[model samples]
Target: MSDSPDDSGALHLKHVLAAAGVTDLTDVFAIRHTAKNDGLPDLWTASPEAVLAYTREQDSRFRVFPENPPRSWLVFMDDGSHEGAHRSRFYGAYENDGEALSERTELNRSFHIKASPLLAAMKNRLVVEWTAPRRWHRRGTLAGDFRVLEIADPQVIPFVGYDKVRLTYQRLKAIVDDPHYSRWHSALSAVKGIYLISDTSNGKQYVGKADGGGGILGRWSAYAHNGHGWNKELAALPKGQCEHFIFSILRVFGPEAIQRQVDEAEGHFKEALLTRGKFGYNAN
Candidate 1:
């Protein structure tokens, strides 16, 4: 089946299949995989290997068609958006029955599948709107049920530009640790800037500046590694309180900008925002 176009003329999964030269779908099954369990890492930011391992585990959990399992499978990971409208990212295509079927257990009944080169280049980059949340798996003959979201850049996200930056502590830590967010690293590392660390849990804020040691990225990296980033006030916070901090840029300066300029900017923000008072987190 083909994806029908809407009035917006947005592309759909059928268009992607057509582009991939996958016209026939009789033996193809499409599946959406999510952590489903709490405390698991979000699939959107998880490492590729982790995503694959999770996918394999979910794929083997049950057999919808034990006697006539599909020969090929289309895999996706939940994008962690709105309940009904989030796009699911394509993980990979696979061939079922890659090995002899394992003995069936109450939960392990599906055939083992091996990754195929089909749409290999599109992994992480291709996202489709999976409308069938209740039915995570469906035969590929029903391709029209899913719509194309977009073919996004493979990075966790590109540099959102300095003024537009806003990151929670966990996301900031992920960007610092994950190589996939190299774009953010490269962009942030090139600029010296004034930043705000707001304790979202209590609404208190700290004004800080990045003038050296690898620029904004380096300064933020310190905060990501230790919630306090050596700041006396933040260090005094009870354990894990820093996890509520949200980082954002207040002003960006080039590498050529002098330390004095950055310091002055930081002072201005601290004074203007009353970030050094009892209501704020800044100690200085």
Candidate 2:
């Protein structure tokens, strides 16, 4: 093992990999996977199997590399710790077979990757600031200059609390569907709440209620499945438009809370946010 952190207390990515016996930096590449509205689950909260599946199925359509694709891959999960500077947690390393596939192919190119143990111990423990914030993927030779933000303890992003709840549509779906997010499911299912959905594309807001027996989880599950939970205005959105919607809670009620009180809370938010106005998405 080598000293991962340097004199300036900054650990360079190249130095870390070099310490891990990755002698051939030219054959390697790095990818920073971020949460998106794209039907894919958030890798940060996804199961280990799901993570591996995503890493192996490097779809050729997105055009990550036009030529000179590397054989070894360094996967990282986009840690949304900052807005401008791109910080990512090292996921793992994988070495693929030496089969070159055409980048123009639209089909999914499944790489036969044998999990590399080179950086196994450092997974999730290593944080690096990606130099190219705009580019999701880059050649390893070019990415070696990334500054290691930390090599601290493994990060555990918990389902902190209901008051702090905020999620994109993609993350909402993951919490509902993925078994890995059962803690989130338990918390959300225990409360009835007035939720807000904001369409980031047009800056429109929708205040909705989740007073069902299944609580907020049940209400949002519908939106997770269909992008719109049968709401008149939400259903009218153009295809894929609802992906821009973000979900958050405004108020919560216990299971025994009166139905009328929940209704009043929902009405209160609608009036305050002016969701029924032209700038909003609420139809009523």
Candidate 3:
């Protein structure tokens, strides 16, 4: 948020933009921060964009793709207006599309901002402190509107591990919500090990493991996808009951670990939790 001069006493959007291949500030597109609003979807709202400065192409429209400004967006999330809270999220980054805009015009609205190069190795690592909060407070096609007054190279916030952590079912779903889960891939579903599912309402714990192709991510994805995860104990319950369950990893194993080893580990956890111990729910 510093105001240090950049040859003009004050840096405009064009100065920092040049670093990201966006020479013209006019070509920028921004979405109103809909976190506190009703029109936007849950993905746009619940996302940490309000405090993280994440750029999105979800409900965006453009006249056409151009060259100098690049067919990409130096997207800025509106930082003011937190539904009367009136504070800034103060985060920014380059949200470029790896694919050609011309090829994507015919695709779905969700397909607009792929930034494939940043998906794997980069993994949304372009987050930077572009400018001080309150700068891009409003939407406009003017020079100062979408301009970034500062740029601090960028930093990476990676997903470290799985042990010593517990999660609600909703949080588990949030981690693998597709576009914003690069950090989760390393810390979550990729973890294959014995897990515990506890019904917060009844205190029943179910033990399981994922030694399949998807590892822990693969196993939990079953729950995320269908709620029951094909378990007899879970299937007997009504739909949406899975959302009330709290999930946690009891242990982790290597991807190359054999199914028998995982099955044995799962058995150990099931015995430890004692599904028959009045608080357990293991049918096997």
| Weakest 10 consecutive residues of candidate 3 by summed lDDT | 116-125
Q: What is the lDDT ranking, best to worst? A: 2, 1, 3
Of candidate 1, the 10-residue stretch with the lowest lDDT total is 57-66
Question: What would the per-residue lDDT of candidate 3 be over residues 98-173, giving only the tens digit for each residue?
Answer: 4334543442233234332211222223222323444432222443333332232234233424653456678777
Q: Please give the distance, in angstroms, between residue 84's alpha carbon in candidate 1 and its true position after superposition.
A: 6.4
Clashing pairs in 1: none
Error of 2 at 116 (Å): 2.2
Cα lDDT tens digits, model 1, 1-284, are: 44456667888777677677777777778888776454233444455566555544443333543355577788887775655677787888887764345645555443566788888878878888887566777787775457777787765564546765778789899899999888889999999999999897888999998887799999999999998888888899999997888888999999998878888999999999999888798878
RMSD of 1: 9.3
Q: Could you give the C-alpha RMSD of every candidate to the true structure, in order shown? A: 9.3, 8.9, 13.1
What's the lDDT for residue 71 in model 1?
77
lDDT of 2 at 37: 59
Q: Model 1 residue 273 lDDT?
A: 94
**Predicted candidate 2 versus true structure: per-residue lDDT over 1-284, tens digit per residue:** 23355667766888888887786778888987876656234554466677666666665654654334588889888776665667788888878774335532466666667677868888877888887678888787777878888785543334536765778888888778887666678888999999999898989999999998789999999999999999888888899998888888899999999999999998889999999969798777
Q: After TM-score superposition, what is the CA distance of residue 214 in candidate 3 from its true location, in Å? A: 0.8
Residue 55 miss distance in model 3 (angstroms): 30
lDDT of 2 at 193: 96
Candidate 2 vs candidate 3: the lDDT winner is: 2
Tell me the lDDT of model 2 at 201: 94
